[model samples]
Target chain A: MPHISLPDHLPGITGLLEFSQNTAAPIRELTQILLRGDNSLTQGERELIATVVSHNNECRFCTSAHTAAADLLLGESETCEMVKYDLDNAPVSDKMKALLTIAKMVQKSGKSVSPEAITNAKAQGATDIEIHDTVLIAALFCLYNRYVDGLASVTPDDSSFYQYLGERIVNHGYTRLPQGYDHLKNS
Target chain B: MAYIKLPDNAAGMRGLMAFRPHLAPHLGAFTEGILCIEDGLTKAEREIIGTLVSKLNDCQLCEGVHGAVAACYLDDNEVLIEQIKEDYKKAPISDKLKALLNIATSVQKGGKYVSESQIQRARDLGATDIEIHDTVIIAATFCFFNRYLDGLGIDPIQDSEIFRQRGRMIAKGLGYAPKK
Candidate 1:
């Protein structure tokens, strides 16, 4: 029921991305840099940020995708789920919990992220880059979540599909995803 | 009152840009790519999209900056900017622009809020696919931009003249690339 015609196989943002390479290339690059690139914030933590925002936004596809990624890196679905449900009580380090609080604030409104929030994060050993990445991860996931839901993209009921995608992304990263559909049309 | 150490004169995202000069380039590149780079939508139209979304997000700083930038291309009509912000549906604008604004508004609420009928309405009003596509991206990007500026507790400039000056620079293709 996507508003636009999308390939049945690709699913969610992947299918929509295949529709246009002009924008997709940059989006893909940005995702790789934001989620998978070199940063003090581990890939697992980054994915957890995205997962939390997606969960807050109630975006099923994104939440599922990032949840799987977080699960892969953290090696504990329970931990990931706990973070999603309640970061305050999650067994994560104090620094991580503080960062997640900031992420939640970003999910709600930038204005809601108060001075106290930054102070708390810093006290817990959150660096400027860590803080910056947390904000960007939360902000960018808003874009990704909205884009996928905006198009009415298809979401698979099967959880394994997302697990497979999560493993592939963890292994090869966001860069190697199929670029576009011109090849599909020719075939 | 800033949480993060920021330049004394800089405000909003600009202050953050000054604080972290290294990350500024990438953000500038993305902003330039989206707003400065010419595509199907005119620069004024794109600015209008940005301004509209900022207003929707209730980020006054962004609404002022982008609205003033939009005004540079729009003959400095402050009234029109106010009108568009207050109520774009009834604003004195073309049907196509109005339709596109509707799409942008829906984008501000959430992507899922955008219905098939909104796309059809824009198309019916003669908006091209690229125009619609750009509008969505512009709106979506503003959500990020607005959040970034506000999340850090950056204050908005009370002086309208400053925004007008910044707007002129952006309209002249300086973009958010930061002052060299």
Candidate 2:
């Protein structure tokens, strides 16, 4: 069914890291900084950017997962749906809407983000850092959306799964797959 | 009136734990390591790659927040960020950054989008192998991060202050604390 079918459970990037201890530390460190760390964005905002982009790519697993996470963070069902599909309709601050618009532009066309969108977001107080971060998040998500979709990993169709993962991710971090969750054997 | 209502990621994180688990710490370190280079690309240029890619991907979460991250380093200069965000090629940045971003853009589209010529151009502009490698990695990793976040559909934190503080923190080297 998938374009490039991997095993039900593949070793993924984790195994590659383990192959070389020296390489692994630096890889892990970089991963953490990109995902978490301080930026002009919150963890939630970053997640939202991923969700929106994935939605465009139509990566079901990513869409569902991030939607669940979005619901968890903002606490609004209609809003989540709106943000998932048409964020313009979603009730958000003007600045945010403009920013979201710009993000979508980046996703759709890297070279198409309108100067007006930038101006609008900036007018609403979007900073250069915020703008840059937005573009970064959008660009990075494009890769993520492709990678997940490219590799036919098991995309669980369960909101509960996302909810569970979200809480832990927020509390702990994306350090390792959950305990007792081994994919190498299955792969 | 940004829609701020939903069940949130807390409820869905459990399912994610089973499949992907928690790897943020590692990813965090990964990003930092890739970004720690002294003089290849200015912090602004590096963040530009990150911001531009995220923008292309259409990840609202990444866009909303990272836009702020890009802004922080730019001294809230939305215009400059916009120039890059709108059109990196025409943006008021050095040719080197523009070329590197072109390479990064290729990665965002698919490595095939990156050709030997682009790499050569970057090298010609004085990009080190390490810098090139890190740039690719950054692009590649963000792709992962973007999908993971989208897979989860986490709500974006729409607070400017939060990201402003984040910019400061990130500019501060993300500090080193032993992992728990």
Please give the range of 10 consecutive residues that has the lowest summed lDDT in model 1 chain B.
B1-10
The regions of model 1 sitting more than 4 angstroms off are: A176-187, B178-180
Query: What tens digits encode model 1's per-residue C-alpha lDDT throughout B44-155?
Result: 8889999999988889899999999989988888889889888888888889999989888888888889999998988898887667767877788898888877776668
Please report, as a residue range, the 10-residue window in candidate 2 chain B with the lowest summed lDDT: B1-10
- lDDT tens readout by residue for model 2, B77-142: 768877888998888888888877887777777543566678778779987754665566567665
Query: What is candidate 1's CA lDDT for residue B68?
Result: 95
Clashing pairs in 1: none
Candidate 1 lDDT tens digits, A30-106: 77887887888889989889999999988899999889999999998998899989777898899999999999999
Please name the candidate that would achieve the greatest TM-score relative to the true structure: 1
Positional deviation of residue B94's Cα in model 1 after best superposition, in angstroms: 1.4
